[model samples]
Target: MASRMDRAQAVVAIGELFREHGYHGTSYGQITAATGLGKGSLYNHFPNGKEDMTRAVLAHVHGWFEDNVFGVLASKTDPMEAVDQMFVQVDDYFRSGRRLCLLGAFSLYDVRTAFDAEIVSYFSRWVETLAGCLKRGGLSAKESKVQAMACMVDIQGGLLMAHAFDDAAIFTSSLARSAKTLRAAMGDRVPA
Candidate 1:
């Protein structure tokens, strides 16, 4: 008999599968194969099955993003630098040859009903964190929130365009344009 797997390892494996194949596109069998766990063993950890596993994956991704991306972005005092670094972080993230965004991929899947609340709450917190950063950079609360939403849309769209075109340049250019626009909006108040 195989040794039992830990919850963290299972969650990480599920996240990798979800990242590669999306929620609906991935199967329980595939997850088991990927994790080297039997069905019963899988269920032992996630009794609710795929939905439960997916929820765990979403939470895992959320926490990872919060700590790595948002945490780093929020650390800098210069709002403009923070915004620029955000793009740099995103560029490095996608340039690492990972074509799919875990959250973006999950949103595309039919398993929407399975993780709706978790996904919504995750995105809401992301937006609020970004908007808060922009507000600190001298933008009005309303402006920051709207701009943050626009930035998120641009990122999603840019990723799609980059993948469709089979080019990273498009993604880089899109981010650069966004940074320029944001800097222009901030005017003299933008960090030196």
Candidate 2:
């Protein structure tokens, strides 16, 4: 159990590095330095080394989004309010767009084979949850799904822009627009 906990901590520590430098950019030396675990122990915990760590990081990211984002969306009874709360949660989670999204960041790397299916499922579940919320708020099924997809595109695009410009406003503004658009589908008047 102690080894399991140590491995979990190592995965989290490595995940933070991957979030900033991406999979290809992150190295075993860096992971060792970050976790203070020598090669022997590192390989002991992750027999497949970087590949294992990347998979663990992806799993960590997937679990976090499921708990922090989708869980909120699922539990809210008021859909528009749920949309509103989700944007707030997203804003906080991303640290106003300063924090890189591990899943989105992974897409830029050649290591997608390590966890592409999980990434797709994470994104699909996110959109499906949003679509369900929108449908609850009165949008037709097709419209709900379309708007959900748009929201996700805007979010990932916004994150890219935020990183490129070194500005949080880009992501925040896009999130606001996403929420407003979702609300508008419910015939709610969105403030300008």
Candidate 3:
């Protein structure tokens, strides 16, 4: 048994564990080791065990994206600049393909059914926010949504390919192509 840590620290430790090993693959022993906390302390912090811990972790991730990613996309001043900022934020957040996407990883596994609502809301909110920005940029509702979904697909799919290839350039190229396509869709002059 080790000393107990603060709840926030424990949540972050547990999140990294979960990110490395999917929900089913992660175990109490690993979490305890990662947090340097005993089983009893973990129980005290997360009464329902991993479920409660995961919910807390998800909430934390969601809050971060809401503030950093979604907030900019929702900004009213300049939607195109917001879209451009999104690429920068996403690249920085993912560490240029050196990091795994926790939400995307979960969605690939069976546990996706367990956390359906959280996962769905995460993707949905991003797409809707981006679509709204495109709409304000003069795109019709249908086309904006189509392009928004395409952009997400490129990002997530690029992540998969980059992870498989062990190459950050793949992800960077994917983002560049997607951004170019978006500019074309918006009838803006695509910078060479």
Candidate 4:
């Protein structure tokens, strides 16, 4: 909030602000304070205002997961490795359950209606790619998808529980349970 920031920097700050305060809860005044940009300067970077900022944040998040998670899952020859990597990537990305998932946050409000397509695609793409990886590991397609969905559920729910309880171990245990489910399915050969 004290230094000059380009558009990308502004978007990252805006994203953290939005994550801390839901879409409806955040105001332009807060954004300006967060980014240290005046209305005129902010408008110059985002002509469409908040909508443009949200789009940029979503795109950044999408691209990161695409390269680091979904894409990794889609291309890895070793399905178990890919799945294990998925959990590691996710754990790091969320800062060990201390950070909120931007897409999940966005999906919790009326903002969901505005960015519904993006939100749906982010979650669905993750499941699909991971399911594909599991199927390659010899899980039946249906079972693979089920396991992927369970992981997703555990992740989202774990984040919520961690935030509510202020306990990262709860989140850790949730992920372990998810991984355990897959490990059980895979005959206990999943990598640690």
Q: lDDT of all predictions, in order shown?
A: 0.76, 0.83, 0.85, 0.88
lDDT computed for candidate 3: 0.85
Candidate 2 local lDDT, 25-85, one digit each (tens): 8887778888888889988989998888888888887788788788877777888788888
Clashing pairs in 2: none
User: Model 1: what TM-score?
Assistant: 0.84
lDDT of 1 by residue, 70-159 (tens): 876677788777777777777776663335567776666777666678778777877787887788878889998898888877777777
lDDT of 4 by residue, 1-192 (tens): 547688888888988888899887889999998888999998999899999889888988999999999999999987777778988998999888998898998898889998999999999999999888888877888998998998899999999889889998888888888887886787644333
lDDT for predicted candidate 2 compared with the true structure: 0.83
lDDT of 1: 0.76
lDDT ranking of the models: 4, 3, 2, 1
Give candidate 3's root-mean-square deviation (CA, Å). 2.9
The predicted structure with the larger TM-score, 2 or 3, is 3
- In model 2, which regions exceed 4 Å deviation? 1-5, 188-192
lDDT of 3 by residue, 50-143 (tens): 9999888888888888998888888855667778889888989888877778888889998888888999999999999999888877788999
TM-score of each: 0.84, 0.90, 0.92, 0.94
Task: Name the candidate that leads on lDDT.
Answer: 4
Question: What pairs collide in candidate 3?
Answer: none
Clashes of 2: 0
